[model samples]
Target: MKNLCYTLLLLSSISSFAQNDSILNFQDETIYRINILLPGLEIEKDVYKDFSVVGNLGLFPGYYKNNNLFSNSEEGFFFIPFIDLQVRYYTNFNRRIEKGKTIVKNTGNFVALKFTNYFGTATDHRSTESVRIAGMAYDIQRTYWDHWHLNFESGLMANFRC
Candidate 1:
């Protein structure tokens, strides 16, 4: 009788732990941003319970035109790369339900710290110009569509160049 009771206790504990593991599992997402028909890729991975990291890569094609803002004619191509580390403290992690489904709660309000780097070169009618920019920003994302699980972000950024 004593051995049977111990076995049952162990089994119960294991089942409880398994259930909790499912509830706290990590989620991941991949996104693409469209820039005037050019596409950029971004990947986001959950790190901790309420934190995640995102990385992005984008490219812009070069063009030549007359009466350009920088000079009579300018042409250049460039790459933009950025990384963002953010935390989302979900206000309704497990409290919301829709159409008999438990609403995923990671898409909530968030604060983010971001770093961006830009390097490029442009050629004008008279001279060639090279530019490098490094920037940091603090951003906030607010949930706009709770049912559809969408959020928008706004931020201020500062840039430095060498």
Candidate 2:
């Protein structure tokens, strides 16, 4: 009786492990911008078990302000639009496993290559000014406790009139 119970338990555990592994297959995610009160969208798609690509687009509408310090009285409107593309490799995919099951997770340390572009125009209720910028950067992102995330990046950038 004891041997039978032990064998059944072992088999059940193995089946559960297999089920968990199957659930970790490639699943794409689309996220709307919430951290900032801006209109934006982000999409992430897994290309392989450990690699993914992400893209984001955002727009900022115009605002006006009075009682300017630099000028006597300043009132203006500005609009900006930006886009970002990134490639990420998840490091924990190869180093962590549980009960013989590998879990695919977005929370981990990742190295990313990114490109960004921005364009905007400002009007001070008088003259109009415009600008454009483009940049490429190497970035590192780390997620902790499945909730907190941080990112650091460095690269060369240039600005131009538009």
- lDDT value, residue 38 of candidate 2: 52
lDDT of 1 by residue, 1-162 (tens): 999999999999998755333323445543333333334555556666556666656654444445757655544443333333333344443443222323233544456666655444433333334444333333333323432223455666666556
Q: Which ten-residue region of model 2 has the weakest summed lDDT? A: 29-38
TM-score of each: 0.46, 0.52
Q: Considering every candidate listed, which one attains the maximal TM-score?
A: 2
- Candidate 2 lDDT (Cα, 0 to 1): 0.60
Error of 1 at 78 (Å): 8.1
lDDT of 2 by residue, 28-56 (tens): 54323322555566666778766788887
Indicate the TM-score of model 1: 0.46
Indicate the TM-score of model 2. Answer: 0.52
